[model samples]
Target: MTAILTFFTTLACIVTLLPFSRHPHWAIRGMDFPRLQFAIFIAVLLIANFVFLNKQSQFTWVVISITALCLAWQLWWILPYTRLWPHEVKETKESSPDKQISIMTANVLTPNRKVDKLIQLVQIHKPDVLVTLESDQWWEDQLKVVEVDMPHSIKCPLDNLYGMHVFSRLPLSNQEIAYLVEKEVPSIHTTLTLDSGDKVRMHFMHPAPPSPTENPQSAERDAELIIVAKSVAKSNQPIIVTGDLNDVAWSATTRLFRKISGLLDPRVGRGMLNTFHADFPFLRWPLDHLFHSQHFTLNSIKRLPPIGSDHFALLTKLTLSPTVGADQTGLESNTSDHNWAKEITENQSISVNDVPQVDNSK
Candidate 1:
């Protein structure tokens, strides 16, 4: 029994350390998804070692130390996302409708046909912007009920399961569909004009995940995000990028994206708000994300109830305050982060389609 426990403890330590390497293999990158679970398992092993192990031999001490170290390593990455740490995005004391915008991002599982539940949530919240990922032709048709109120929209309904559509009540200018890394995957890039006449650039993406059945590496997904992060870095406009990123919030790649783009995650110091694996409470991570520039102060952020999809929708209300960026912490990037960003972007072999032309004449 002691040998088996020691073996599993060693395995947990190995899995925890694998994500530190720069390798893109699914097995290595996949370790970034379950830090919380790993921490819990490590804790259990530590307790079992103390209670079940009668002989405190050298091997027992080694295993216990490894379990403790692994737990600390996992907590180092996850602690910031919990209330115990400071929030990366500051919370606003109050907000006016004219200066605030609510965004709802839902990755409606392509095969799940319960579109009415999503529509009902839309009607209830009436967000300024609604971004649906994995939304093919069927979803586009089902979501038509919003056209009566949300006049400005962009639709790219593909059968490849990467289809994305954005519906907004606010005016959207320079609306274009971009194939950032993969031609089959479509992302929405546009400037949303708030009621205050300020323009905020919005980028919605659903990059393919690293899985056995899908892309076996994380390079493409990482590169697509790096491309967006670099593109937004050139502009001073307030930016909001949201979607099912297919990566967890605590991953090194996601952190690099946030640092390079200077976007703040409301999840920091709030909660995990895990959205994926809606059917399995025990196996879930925060795959759906809403990241924005520091100019926005979070009003409210929460995971909406399940809508018959594998991912739970995320709703975020942010108040746009031009001076708020100066007050926020941890949004700045260092020279090393920028250098790594360049390396990651240049190393990607994926080809992106030419930027789609946007007509603002409407």
Candidate 2:
């Protein structure tokens, strides 16, 4: 029994460590196979330790230690989702009134027929901006009523699941549909002019998922994310990037993006607002995120009611401000730049002019 326990414990350690390495090869086809394999191995070991092994035995200490290590590793990945990290709200000196910008981002599952539920959610929130992923021509038409209220909008309707649509009460500047990965898979990039005349760049992405039926590899997705991150890092305007990233908040790629972009996640130190698998909340991870530059302060963050989609909508309100200086207090450190962004940017053929501009008002 001790031998059996030791073997399983060793296997669990191997499974957990396989996904820790920062290699894109491990992130294939909309599935982090290594992470999944590790999770399963850990579960098996945990069950064996509790159910099969004697608690008072010396072997049990070995099992507990192994289990604790695995749990610690898992917790490390989940740190960003907890939003516990202290964040600095740069002092404005004059007590500037909060400039709230409410946004609602939803991956309205393309095949989902519950349009009413989505519409209802929007009406209730009355968000300043609405971003929908997996939206096609039909979904666009269903949301037409909102246009009268929103006035400014960007629509990229495609039969492919990559279709994305953005509607905003704020004026749009340099709005374009960018093909970041495959030619057909597009992401929306635009500058939002707020009521205060402040401009903030927003990137709404729904890249091709890494799945057997989809891209079958995560290279394109990872590359696209890295490209956007690098671009935002160099931008002077506040950046608000949102979408169904198809990667978890705790994943290696996601952390790398945050570091490269110099963006702040609202979930850090706060609970993980797992948006996917709405039907099975416990099994879900945060795939939908609202990441912004340090120039903005989070007003609120929430998970909206499900609208017959695999993902639950994420709503976030941010108040924008200018960065005081590099020595600004309250800014959390310890973020690591893995040099992934520089490598991907070197090979990307991204030209802001190459993106297509569409006037949905027409």
Instruction: List the candidate 2 regions with Cα displacement exceeding 4 Å.
Output: 1-11, 26-60, 83-98, 323-338, 345-362
Tell me which residue pairs clash in candidate 1: none
Alpha carbon lDDT at 273, candidate 2: 78
TM-scores for all candidates: the values are 0.95, 0.84
| Candidate 1 residue-wise lDDT, 1-362, digit = tens | 88888788888879888998989999999999989998888889888887777655887787788888888999999998898988888888767779999999999989999998999999999999999999999999999999888988999998888999999999998888877777788888888899998888888999999999999999889998888887776667788899999999999999999888777899999989999889999999999999987789989999998899999999999999768656785557889888877777778754223333332323
Highest TM-score model number: 1
Worst 10 residues of 2 by lDDT: 353-362
The C-alpha stretches of model 1 lying farther than 4 A from their native spots are 349-362
Model-by-model lDDT, in order?
0.87, 0.73
For 215-295, candidate 2 gives per-residue lDDT tens digits of 665667777787777667666667788998887776767777877778877777667777988887556777898888777
